[model samples]
Target: MPETPPRARALETDTIRRLPKVLLHDHLDGGVRPGTVLELSHEQGYAALPAEDVDALSAWFAQAADSGSLARYLETFAHTVGVTQTAAALTRVARECVLDLAADGVVYAEVRYAPEQHLEGGLSLDEVVRAVNQGLREGEEEMTALAGPDRGQAAPAGPIRVRAILTAMRHAARSREIAELAVRHREAEVCGFDIAGAEDGFPPTRHLAAFEFLRQENSHFTIHAGEAFGLPSIWEAVQLCGAERLGHGIRIVDDITVDGRPVTDDLASAIARSRTEPEAFALGPLAGYVRDRRIALEMCPSSNVQTGAAPSIEKHAITLLTQLMFRVTLNTDNRLMSATSMSREAQLLVDRAGWTWTDLRRVTVNAMKSAFLPFDERLRIIEDVLKPAYDD
Candidate 1:
C-alpha cells in the first residue's frame, strides 16, 4: 500500500473549474479542436489524417501522445499544421483557441505558433500574423457577446484577453526574420517571441543573433529547454540567451541533491524525517539560481510524460519542485494532443500531487507575474480578478 500525499486546502473539481486562470505557454497550432481539424482537413483537401471521424481521430491523438511514441505523437502535429496553411484556417483556429480558453475560465492567455509553418499556402509572415490576430480579436468579441451586456471593457478582463507569441522553429534558420516579425507586430496581437523544437542537438544559442536582436530591441522571449534535453539546454536558454521564462524547465530539478541522492518524494522524506539541513535538500548551482531568481517553470506534466521528460503524472518532478517551493506553473502544452485544458491540468495536480486551492492560486499568480503583459496591468488582474475569485 502507498501512503497518501498530504493536502492543504484542496478544492473540489467543480470549484477548480470555476477558478480563473492565466496561461503563458500554449500552442495555437497544437490546440485546435478535433472536429475543427477534420473540418479544415476536408475543406482544404488534405487527406492524410489517420481517421476522418472526429471521435476516432481525437482518440488516436490521445493514444499516440500517451503511448510513448514520440514519432507518432509528432505525426499528429503534421496533420494539424498541414491543414492550417490557409489564412482562413489559421484565423478560425486562432479564434477557436481563444474561445476555448475563455470558456475554460482562462482570463489571460499567450498562444504561440510558428508563422513559418503556415506559409505552405503562400501566406506571408505578416499575413499569417494578420489572420491570427483577426481571429483573436473576433474571438474576443464573440466571447464578449456571449457574456451579458453588463460587462463592457471589463468583459476582457473576465472573459479572456489573448495575445499571440510568434514562434520560430529551432531546426530552421529564419529565427532572425521571425524575431523581426514579432517586433514589427508587437502592437498587434503579437506580444513576444519563442523558438521551439527538439532540444537535443539544437541549442537555443544557435539563434543567438535573433536573441541578440530581441535584446537590442528590448523585447521578451522564451526558449524551449530542459524537456527532451538536460541542464545544458536550460543553462543556455537562461545564462546565454536571457530567456525571461523557461518553457518546461523541469530538468532544473536535476541540480538538487540530498545526501548524494536526487530529491524525489521518497528521498526528500528521508531529509525531512531527519530534521536536518546540513546535507539535506542541497540545490545544485543551476537549481539554486533558478529557485532564487524565481524563474517560472512551465511544467506541462501530460506533455512532459508524452515526450519522456517525466515518467508519469503522479511521479512528475513538479510534485517535488512544488513541495520544495520552486516557481512551478501548470500549462497545457498542446490540448489536442494531450487531451487536456487548464482546468484539467489543475485538477490532475490536485489529484496526483495533493495540491490545494492555495497551491493552485500560487501557480496561477506565478504565471500571471511571468506573463508578457505589462507589469502594471498584470498586477491589476492579480488584484482585481484572480485574488478575489480565489477568495470566493
Candidate 2:
C-alpha cells in the first residue's frame, strides 16, 4: 500500500476548537438550532416543519441544503424565517446565536439578517432591530455569567462581543430603506450593512442605492458575491459598489492561474510562492486588485461545497487563495445549513489541503484586521486578545 498524501493529514479534531476564532459572515435566521426550530414552531403555532424528531429534523435540513442550486439551498430558510416572524422568536434565536458561538470559542462575530423578512408578524422594522439588539445584549450577559465559576477555564477568556449587520435581500427592492435603518442604528448595536440573496441575475448593483448610502455615511458593508456566480459578480461587488469585504468570494479563484503546481503539496510553500514571484502565477486584474487592496474574501469552505460553488473541500479555491497570499478569512456562512464552524472550516483545510497552524493563525489575524469594528477596537482585540491566545 502507498503512503497517504500530506494533504490527507488532520490535526486532533479538538485542537482547532481550542483556538480563539472570529466570525464575519454568519446569518442570524439561517443558524437557528434544529431543536429550537421544532420548539419555536410549536410555540408560534407554525406547523410546517417536515420532521418532528430532532436528529431527523437536522438531517432533513442538511439534505435540503445539499442541493447544488443556491436558490434551492436558500429555500431551506423558509421554515426558520417562518417561525422567527415575532419579536419573541427573534430574540430567543439571537440570544442562542451568541451563546452557541461563545461556547465554540468564538471571541467576536458579526451576525447578519434582513429586517424586512421579520415584519410578517406585523412588527415595525425598528421594532425588529431593537428586539434583536436586546437579545444580543442579554446573550452576551448570559455568556459572561455562565463562564463565572461553573465552567472555570473552559470558558473563553474575556467577554464575547457581538454586533449586528442589517442585510437587505438582493432580489427585493427595499435596500435603500434598509440602508437607512442600518444608519439609524449605527450608534446603537448595528455595526455595518450587507446585501444577500441569490446572485445569478440579482447583482449587488441592484442595491447600488444602498451601497452609496452606506458609503456616504462612512459605514462598512459586505456583498455576497463570487460564490454561485463568478469573477464578473465579484468585480461588480468590489469595483462598482465598493464592498469592504466579499461574502463567499471563493470564485475569486477564477481570476488566478498557476504556472506550475507546487512540487510539494504543503500549504506553507504555496503561500511563499504568492509573496515571492509573479512569473510562477498569473493573477488577473480583479484578483490582483483584491489582493493588493487588502479586500477580504469572506471564504466559507463547507458552505461553498454545499452550494456547489466548489465540488469538494479538497478542490475549494481557498487553498489556492491561501497559497497565493490573498486576503482570506474563514467563515461559517450558515451554521445549521452548512453544519460548520470557524474551527471546522480550518480543520477541513488542514485535513484536505495540508494547512498548517501558521496558516490558521494568519487567517485568524486576517479576519481580526478586517473586522467591521472601529480601528482602535479591532486593534485592542488583536493585540490584547488574539495575539496572546495564538502566540503561545
Candidate 3:
C-alpha cells in the first residue's frame, strides 16, 4: 500500500469533522458518555464499574473492548447497559448519542439497541422504546435549535436526524416482539428492526418468524451478520432472513478470490490490483448477488479491527469492497467501546487506508441511500445536504 499523499496527510481533523456523514449501524448502549455512565451509576447505586474516575472508566472500556475477541469486546457493554436500566438513563444516553453525532457532523443516523436488555428497571419493552424515542426526538430538537436558522450554512454542526432501530438479542427469543415494537413505533422515531448478538451458533434463521412478520407488515430490517462469523452468516441474513442492509458485512470478502486464489495477505494490494486487473478477481455467487442487488454493507473500521473481523484499518475489507463497487457504507458501531465517531472512522480510512474525500463522500451517500428513511427524505439529504457538503 502506498503512503497517504502529503496533501491528504495535511488534511485537518476539523475539515474531516465538518464533513456531513450518514451512519447506519451505531449502537445506543454502546455509545454512552463516560461521564454520563459515572453519574448514572451513582444515581442508580450500581457499583460494578471497574473504574471510578471518568477518564479511567473511559480508558478501561476502550482497553477492554480492544481485546481482539468479539465476545470479549461485547463484555464491556455490561457497564453501559447496567446503568441504563431506567427511563431517564436511557433517554439521557439516547439524547447524548444524537448530539454527539451531530457535533461530529452526522447528518443522519439509525441508532439501534435491544429494548429487552433495558427492561431490568421494571420498564416494559414498549416503555423502553418510548423512552429512547423521546430522547432521540429531544436530541434532534436541541440540535436543530443549536444550529439556528442559518444552520448548515453558518454552523458546521448541523442538525442530525436520528431514528431508532429496535434490536432483538439473537441469543434471546424476543425477536418477534421487538419487530412488532419497531413497527408499532415506526411513526414515533423507530424506523426498523434488527437481530444482534453473537453471530456464531445462533443464525439469523432463528429469527425467521420475526423477519417474516416484519415483511408482512411492510417494515424494514437489517441483520447482524459477517462480523464475528463468516460468509454463511451473511448468506443466511441476505438469502434466508431478508436483511435490507448488513451490519458489519465485511466478511463478504471471503467470497471473493484474487488471482484465482483466496485473499490471504496484503488485502490492500490485492484490492488495488483487482481494480487495475479486473480479470484477476472473481466474485462467488453470493458476492455477485450482494453487489448486483446493491445490499448495503455497514462496515465499521475501528470496531471491525477491535473485534478481529479485520486485521487493521488500512487492510480492512471496506476499501476492497468499495473498490469492487459494492454498496459500502462506513460506520462507527460503538462510539464508546470503539472510542470512535463518524469523523474518526473517516479519518482512519483517509490516513491509514489512503481514502480520498471522494471515497468518504461516496460512502456517506451510500449510507444515506441505504438508511431506513422515507424515500423523499433520503433523496433530499443526498441532494441537498450530503452532496453539497462534499462538493464544497
Global CA lDDT computed for model 1: 0.85
Candidate 3 local lDDT, 210-262, one digit each (tens): 99999999999999999999999999999999998999998898889986777
Q: What TM-score does candidate 2 get on C-alpha atoms? A: 0.92
| Residue 97, candidate 1: C-alpha displacement in angstroms | 0.6
The whole-model C-alpha lDDT of candidate 2 against the native structure comes to 0.85
In terms of TM-score, the best-performing candidate is 3
lDDT of each: 0.85, 0.85, 0.89
Prediction-by-prediction clash tally: 0, 0, 0
Top candidate on lDDT is 3
Deviation in angstroms for 344 in model 2?
1.8
TM-scores, each model vs. reference: 0.92, 0.92, 0.95
lDDT of 2 by residue, 1-392 (tens): 88533224345566567678889989998899999999999988898999997999999998999988899999999999999998988899999999888878888999999999999999999999999998999999987777655676545554698999999999999999999999999887799999999899999998898899889999889999998888889999999999999998887766666664532244345445654564587787898899999999998888888888887787677877876788899899999998777778888888887778777878888998999898899999889888876665
lDDT of 3 at 256: 90
**Which residue window of length 10 is worst by lDDT in model 1?**
270-279
- Extract clashing residue pairs from model 2: none
lDDT by residue for model 1 (156-264), tens: 3346899999999998999999999999999996889999986778999999999999999989898888888889999999999998889999888778877677765
